[model samples]
Target chain A: MSTAYGVAAVVLVVLASALIGGFGIRLSRTTSDFYVASRTVSPLWNASAIGGEYLSAASFLGVAGLILVHGADMLWLPVGWTGGYLVLLVLVSAPLRRSGAYTLPDFAEARLESMLVRRTAGVLVVLIGWLYLMPQFQSAGLVLRAITGAPEGVGGLLVAAVVAVNVLSGGMRSITFVQAFQYWLKLTALAVPLVFLLLAWRADGTPGPGAGAATWALPLAGGREYGLYSTYSLILATFLGTMGLPHVLVRFYTNPDGRAARRTTLAVLALLGAFYLMPAVYGTLGRIYLPGLRGGDMVVLTLPARLVGGVAGDLLTALVTAGAFAAFLSTSSGLTVSVAGVIGQDILRGGVRSFQAAAVVAVVVPLGLASLTRPLPVADVVGLAFAVAASSFCPLLVLGIWWRRLTSAGATAGLLTGGGLACGAVLLTLVGGPHTGLAGALLAQPAAWSVPVAFVVMIVVSLLTPGRIPPGVARIMVRLHTPETLDLDRGDWRPRSS
Target chain B: MATRHDDASVYERIEADDRFRELRRRFRSWVFPMTAAFLAWYLLYVALSGWARDLMAVKVLGNVNVALVLGLLQFVSTFLIAWAYSRYAARRLDPLAGEIRAEAEHEAERERA
Candidate 1:
C-alpha cells in the first residue's frame, strides 16, 4: 500500500515537470531564450526557479537528518548555505550580470582575456557540476531504496532519464518555469505537514529538546578559536564561490540590469532563508522522534511515517518523496544546462544539434560515476564541490572583476593550483578513511585551503607575467560598464535566426 | 584596466587614474592586511584540527563532537569575509568606479565635437 503511494507521488512529480516543460517549449524561440530566457525573467519567477533548484535533496532531507544526528553544529550547513546567497547579493550579482557572460568560462575569458583561462574555467565548472551532481544521483538511489525497497541503482537511473529529457527538450527556458514551480510545490508539501507536526509535538506532552539534545546548547567547544577558523573558512568559500558556480552565475545574466540583478538576489535570499529554516525544524524534530533508527541520516524520510503512521503516514511520505524528486530533478536540470552550455561553447559548436548532444554527454558521464560509487555524506560531497569551485573559478571571478592587475596567465595558474589541489583532496577522500577534525574537514571540505591557494597563485603569477595582461582590458571594461540598453550584444544574444 | 598607447612608448598604459591610485592607496590601508589576518585565522583552524589533533581534547555535545567548533567557524568566517569584502568594495571600489564613470561620461561629451 505504501509502495503504491510512493509510486503515485513520483509519477505526479514527473508529470508536473514534463507538463511545465511542454508549455515552456512553446515559448522557447531564440537561442537566448533557450539559454537564458532572453534575459527578461521577472524576479518572482526567477526567485521561484532559484528556490526550486537550490532546495536539493540535501536541503530538503539531508540537512535535517544531519541535524538530527549532529546537533547544532549541523545547523551551520543551512546557515552557511543561505548566507552564501546573501554574500552573492552584496558582492557579485549585479556586476557579474553586467559582465555579460553566459557561463563561468565566458566570465573568465572576458575578465582575463585569454582562451586558455577560459578553457581552464570551463573544465573546473564541469568538475564542480559533476561533483555536485554525484550526490544528487546517490540520494535519488537512496530515496528509492528507502521508499520502494528497490535496489539503489533504480532511482539514480530514473532521475537521469527524467532530467535529461526535460533539459534536452526545453533547455534553460523551460527548466526555469519548471524549477520555479517545483520550489513552491516542494515548500508547500514539506511546510503543511511541519505545522501539523509542531502541533502534534506540542500536544504529545511537548517534550523538551530531547535526551541527547543538551550537547547542542554549547556553541563552541572551548573558546572561539576553532569556531573562528571554521566559520571564516566556510565564509570565504561560500561568499567567493557563488560567482563561480555555473548554475548560480548563469542565473544572474538573466536579469536585465544591475538593479534587477540586486533585487533578484535579495528575493532569492529571502526565499532561501525561509526554506532553510524548515529543514532545521525537521532535523530538530527528527532527534526527538527517530533517535533509535540506523543511519540517523535517513531520518527525514522516516519522520513523517513515524509521526503519522498508517494511511496518513503513507500520504505524508509520498508528499516528502515527491518533494525529494522535485529537488533532484530541478538541481540536476540546472546542472545539466550549465555543464551542457560549457561543453557546447568550449568543446562543441553550441549549435542546436551540438547542444542536444552535449546535454546527453553532460548527464550521462556523472550518472555512470554515481552508479559505480557511493559518495560521502551529502553535506561533505556538496562541500567538496564548493572547495573545487573556490580553488578554480572563484579566484578568476573575484580577481577578474575587482583587480586590474590580473592576467590570463595568472588565472590559468590559479585554476591549476586550486583545482588541482582540490581534485587531489577529493581523491584522498575517496581513497582514505576519515582524517582528523581540521584535516577531515579540509579533506572533506577543502574550500578554505583551495580558495586561498587559488587566490595566492593568481596574485603571484600575475605579478611575474605582468606583460601578458590583455591590451583590450580598457575597452572591455567600457563595454562591461555600459548599461543594458546601450549594450552592443543585446540584440546579438537575442538573434532570431537559429 | 589600461589604455592602448602607440608602439614607440616603452611601457603599457599602466597609469593609475587619479581615483584608482587613491583606491589602491586606500585598499592597502586596512583591508589587504585585514584579509590576510582573517585568512590566517582560517588556516590555524585547519592546522589545529588536522595536524594538531592532540592539541585539544574532544568533548561531546549532544552527538556533535568538540571539533564542530572549528567546523562552525568556517561558516562564521564566510559571513565575516563577505561583510568585509562588501564594506571594502562599497567604500573604496565604488567611489573609484563612480569617478571613472563620471570621467568617461565627461570625455564622451567632449568628444561629440
Candidate 2:
C-alpha cells in the first residue's frame, strides 16, 4: 500500500475523533452526563456505541488473523465475542441498569453495602481495564507499522495521547457520540472494500483455501493438544466474560431504565451479529487468496492489495487502516474512561479534575506496559483478559444479583480466589514461556478451573459467613430487581429527566 | 403499607406483594430457561467441535460443512434469543413489574398522607 494513502487515512481518523470528542463535551453537563450520559441515550445510539466500543482490534484484525492461521476453530473467537452479548442481554443487562450505579464498584457497594467488597471490586475493575487496554495499544502499533511503516511505538503513543485527551476532556458523554459514529464508519470501511474484494475473487474464479488439507475445515483440526479442554475453557471465559467488562457494564448505566437496557442489548446483538460476519469473510478470503502470510494480523491489511492490485486497492487498504485505527481509538477510549472512572473514584477525590488526572494515568500505565511487554498475539492477550474477568466478575455479578444470602466476605473471597488465580495464570503465561503438557494448557487457559473455583468458594464462604450479610440486602435487591415505574421512595434517588 | 423512610419494610411489602411475586416469577420463568438453553447450545457446539471433528467436518453444501453452518447458527441463536427475550420482557415481564411499581408508589403515597 502507498505510504501517503496510509498516513492520510490515519490522520483523517484521528482528526475526526478529536473533533467529535472536543465538541461532544459542549453537549454534555452534570455529573450524570459525565458518568452515564445522563441516562438519556436511546437504544439505537447506545447499541451503536456499545458495538463501537466492544469490537476492539481483536475483532477488527485479530479474528481474521487467527482464522487465517488456525482455520475453522478460530471462528469461535468471533462467535463467543458476539454471543457474549447475548449472555449479557438475558442475565445482567436490565438489573444492572436498574441498580443506577456509575461503575462496577458502585454496583458492588450498592449491592453488598460493604466498603471492603466495593474496594476489592474497584481494584479488579482497574486491573481488568488495564489488562484489556494494553492489547489495544499494542495492536495500534501493529496497525500503524503495518500501514505507514512507522516505528511500532508511534502507534501506541499516538493512541494513548488521543484516548487520554478524549476522556479527560469530556469523559463518557463525549465518547458515546464518537463511538457510535465510529461503529458505522468501521462497518462501512470494512464492508465497502469487501464487495470489491469479493467481485475480484469471483472474477478470478475464487480458489478454495489453498486446496486445503481437509483438516483445515475441521473445527478442532491440526492435532491441537487438549483441544477439547481448551475449547471449553475459551467458551467458559467469553460466554461469561461479556457481562463482566467494566466498559460494557457502564454502557448499560447510560440507559434510562432496565427496559431500555434490554432494548439496547438486543440492538447490540443485531449490530454486532452483522459486524462480526464481515471479518470471517476477510479471514476466509485471505486463506484462499493470500496464503502463507507471515503475520495473520496483517492479512486484513494486505488481502485487498494482494487480491485487487492498483490505486483502487491501495485506497481500500487505506480504508481498512482507518477502520483498524477506529477500532483501537474507540476501544481504548472506552477502557480509559472506565479505568479512569474507577481510579478517580477510589484513588483520588471524585470530580472532573480527578477524572482527568486518572485518565492520563490509565492510558499511560498501559502505554508503558505495552512498550515493555513482549507482544503476544493480540487476540490471545484479549482472551486472557476475558478469562480473568469471567473468573472474577462473572461470579460476582451473577451471585450478587440473584442470591440475597451473599455476604461481603463471600464476595471478596470469591473475587480474590477467582480473579486472583486467573491473573496469576495470565502472568505465568506471559512470563513463564510456553509450556508443553497439561500444565501448559491449564495455565494457558485458566477460566475452566478458575470460574468454578470462584463460584464454589463464594457459595461456601457466604454459607459460613451467614451473619455477615448486609442488612440492606432486601432494599438493594428490591431496587435492582424492581421496575423503575415503582414509586416507592427508593432512597438516595436522582431525577432521571435531566 | 409502610412509612416513607422505612426502606426495609417497604421492600418487605413489595416482596410480599402478589404482583411483585408474579413479576419475579414470570421474569425468572423465561430468563432462567433461556439462559440455561443458550449455555447448553453453546457448550454443545464446543463439545462437538472438540470431540467430534468428523461430524463437524461432514460436508452439507459445496465448500460448506456442518461446522460452518453450526458456526453461523451460533449467531442465529444469539439474535433469536435476544429478540425473543426482548419481546417476552415487553409483553409479559414489564407489565407485571409496572403493576408492582405502581402499587409500591401508591403505598408510599398513602403512608405519606
* RMSD of candidates 1 onward, in order: 6.0, 2.2
lDDT of 2: 0.86
**Candidate 1 lDDT, tens digit per residue, A1-498?**
389999899999999999989888877766787688887888888888988887787788778876776665566566667666754665455456666667777777777668888788888889889988888989988888888999998898899999989887888889988999999988987897787688878788766566545454333333223554555566566656666667887887777665466556666766776777777778778878777665455776777777777898788888889998999999999989989888877798766667778898988898988976655567667766776877787677667767778888888998999999989988788657346666766676677778877899999999999898888676555444343233233111221234
Estimated TM-score for each candidate? 0.82, 0.96
Candidate lDDT (C-alpha), each = 0.72, 0.86
Best by TM-score: 2
The residue-by-residue lDDT of candidate 2 on A156-196, one tens digit each, is 99999998888877878889989998999899989999999
Q: What is the lDDT of residue A157 in candidate 2?
A: 97
> For candidate 2, what's the RMSD?
2.2
Query: Residue B34 of candidate 1: its Cα lDDT?
Result: 59
lDDT of 1: 0.72
Q: What is the lDDT of residue A181 in candidate 1?
A: 91
Stretches > 4 Å off in candidate 2: A489-498, B1-4
